[model samples]
Each structure stands twice: as structure tokens, then as C-alpha cells.
Target: MMTSLFDQFASPTMLGIPLIVIAVMLPWTMFPSPTPQWVTNRVITIQMWLANRFTNQLMTPLSLGGHKWALLLTSLMLYLITINMLGLLPYTFTPTTQLSMNMGFAFPLWLATLIIGMRDQPTMSLGHLLPEGTPVPLIPALIVIETISLFIRPLALGVRLTANLTAGHLLIQLLATAVYVLLPLMPTVALLTAAVFFLLTLLEIAVALIQAYVFVLLLSLYLQENI
Candidate 1:
């Protein structure tokens, strides 16, 4: 089996570690960007110039309440999807599969929710977590429950994405390993197993994209709720 170094760890960590590395490496990719440094710098300068030119010309621009947020989220989705799918390469790691990477995204999401919610409904937003309709006697319990729930949203998001990607990658790795392990003992069965693993890799690509979209969609939904 042609396995990457990332596959050496326990199943959970196999995807987790690479995912974290990928997230940390994201910003650095811009420095010596996949493109030539000079090219990248020129592109950046041109983009800035164009953006400034547009800003000066625009007037009475119709904007959504969350237009900035939407653009930010779209950038996030593009970056995450690109990085996650990059793991499909022969020896690359997928950072989206790591706890740290997922949590990095989740933390911002959690904070954004709170900030936007409070901004949108200053007096009612934070307070409405418990809702006025709740019985006065249960307000304390409700508040506690809502607080816990709000905090857990990011945790759930992190765990869900990390676990899904990690499990999928591990499953493919194990299946591939099994093919090699059994090849000498039973050539026919081993070949069939290897074929299965090849199919599994195809499915994993789809899973990777779905996971990225799900994470972005959930984040958007959270912002929508708050906004």
C-alpha cells in the first residue's frame, strides 16, 4: 500500500494531525504562494488597486445586513475545500480532519455568533437566549441550558467534521493495508480488496467536498440565526 506519513498514527490522529498542519500552513501558503512570489505580489497589488477604484465609484450600494459576513464565509469555504481536497493527493495531509483545525474555525464561528447576535438585538439578543416566554421560575434553568447549548455548538461542529473526515480516511487506509497484507496469502481476494479500496478513494473525494460544504453551511446558518 502506498501510504502517506500521515497514515502512521492511530486512526483518529491520522487525519487530525495533518488537518492541524494544513490549517497552520494556510497563511504561509500566501508568502511563497503556490504561484511565483513576484506574480503573487503583483496580483495582490493589482487587486488592491482595483478594489480601491471600485470603492470610490460605488454609491447607494445595496448591501445585505450580512454582506461582509457572506463574503468572509465564501472565502473560508474556498480555502477549506481546497485544503481538504488536497489531502486526496498521494502524500499530502488534510487539515480539515484535525481537531485543532476544526476548532480554529469553530472558535471564530462561536465568537461571531455572539458578537452579531448582541449587535443585532443589543437588549434582546443575549437576553433572548432564555426567551421571555419561559416561566419566571424556570428562567435560571433555561439560561443555564441555553448557555451550555451555545457553547457546545462550536464543539459539536469541530467534533463532527474531524470525526467524519478522520474516520473516512482511516477506513480507506485500513482497507488498503488489508489488501497488501492479504495479497501474498490470497492473491484473488487481495486483488478484489484493493479494487474496493480504489473505489473507496473515489467516494472519499465526494465526502471531503460534502464535509467542507456542511461546515460552511452550518456556519452560515449560525450567522443567519444571529443576524
Candidate 2:
């Protein structure tokens, strides 16, 4: 039987148990924990530097109240980048490929921002629904449209990450299949195809990193409006 190209995305199972849990947790285990010492190794030094840089950049625009999310957001960024990088490895599952998983991450966080806005600044939150200069005739229609867009934010977040990762994986798989097929019939073309596959793999790596950063960046933006 011919196998589907999309089958790589199937959630891995062992003895009827889904392996997504392992995939998610495995990345964290790979990270080395810091320790107290006169001096640290290069790994620890680089990690500390990156952690500090990321947090400072992320929290720069938010108020002091929003700085409270520094740990949570920084942890999330590392978690996502780890899983995404790990997924690029052979025979590994990417939990973020699942829309359900993506939604699980996006919804609560987005809702938290919305809740903060409504709680702390009800007037400002409601004001966003209608612009100050909205024409009289378009007031009702504008409200309806903005309300719909507001509710759509979480869905957009989840779907954007899922779709970008899914598309990249599908393209990589297709090119790989082509390389295998061409190897037997046309050695020269197969070599060129293999070259392209290598380039695509690099692009996918960048995509994984970029998508994770974009996801967290958007969440920060949402939080900024609230705080």
C-alpha cells in the first residue's frame, strides 16, 4: 500500500498510548541545569546570556505589572523553541503540529490578556470596539466586525503556527520523496534534488525558530495592550 505523505504528522503511539507527552517533556530534560560555582562552563554562560537578553527585550514595552509575566513568557519561549528544534530531528514528533495543542497554548494566554484588559481598564477595552471618529451610519457594522475580529484572535494564533509548520513539513517530505525516486533513474538530478533538500531543511529550521518567536512576540503585544 502506498503511504500518505502527511503520515509523518500522525501522533506517534506506543501500545495505545500517545507519545506527545514524551515529545513535549523530552526537550526540557535535554537542557543542563545551572549550578553554583566560582565560574561556569560555556553552555551555562551562553544560556544565562540568552535568557537575560530574551527577557529584557520581551518585557521592555510592558509596564511593571506586565513584568510579572517575565518568567512565564520566557519559559514559554524556551519550551517552544526546544520542541520546535527537536522536531526537526529524524523519527521525532512535533506536538505543535496538532491544532488542538496549539489552541491549548493560545487560548488561555490570549484570554488572560483579554481578561486583564476588561478587568483593569473596562473603558479602554470597550473603547477599542469603536473608534472615536466612526461614522454614524457605520457604527453598528463596525462594532460587529471588530467584535468578530477580537474573538478570532486566539484562533488566528493557533492556526497560524499549525499551518506554517505543517506546510513546511509537507514540502520537506515531498522533496525528500523526489530525491529518493530520482536517485535510481537519474543520478545527476538526484544529486541536485538532494542539494535542494539540504537547503530546504535549513529553511525549515529557520521557520521553526521564526514561528516560535512570532508566536511569543504576538502574545507580548496582546499583553502590552492589556497592561
Best-performing candidate as measured by TM-score: 2
After superposition, candidate 1 runs with Cα above 4 Å error: 1-63
- Shift in Å, residue 28, candidate 2: 0.9
Candidate 2 deviant stretches above 4 angstroms: none
**For every model in order, what is the number of clashing pairs?**
2, 0
lDDT of each: 0.71, 0.92
What does candidate 2's lDDT look like per residue over 52-171, in tens digits? 999999999999999999999999888988988888888899999999999999999999999999999989988889999989999999999999988999999999999999998888
Highest lDDT scorer: 2
Q: Write the per-residue lDDT of candidate 1 for residues 73-173, one digit (tens) a residue.
A: 65566566677677677655676776876899988877887798798766766775778689899988899999898889899889988888888878887
Pairing residues by index, what is the TM-score of model 2? 0.97
Cα displacement (angstroms), candidate 1, residue 88, comes to 2.0
TM-score of each: 0.71, 0.97
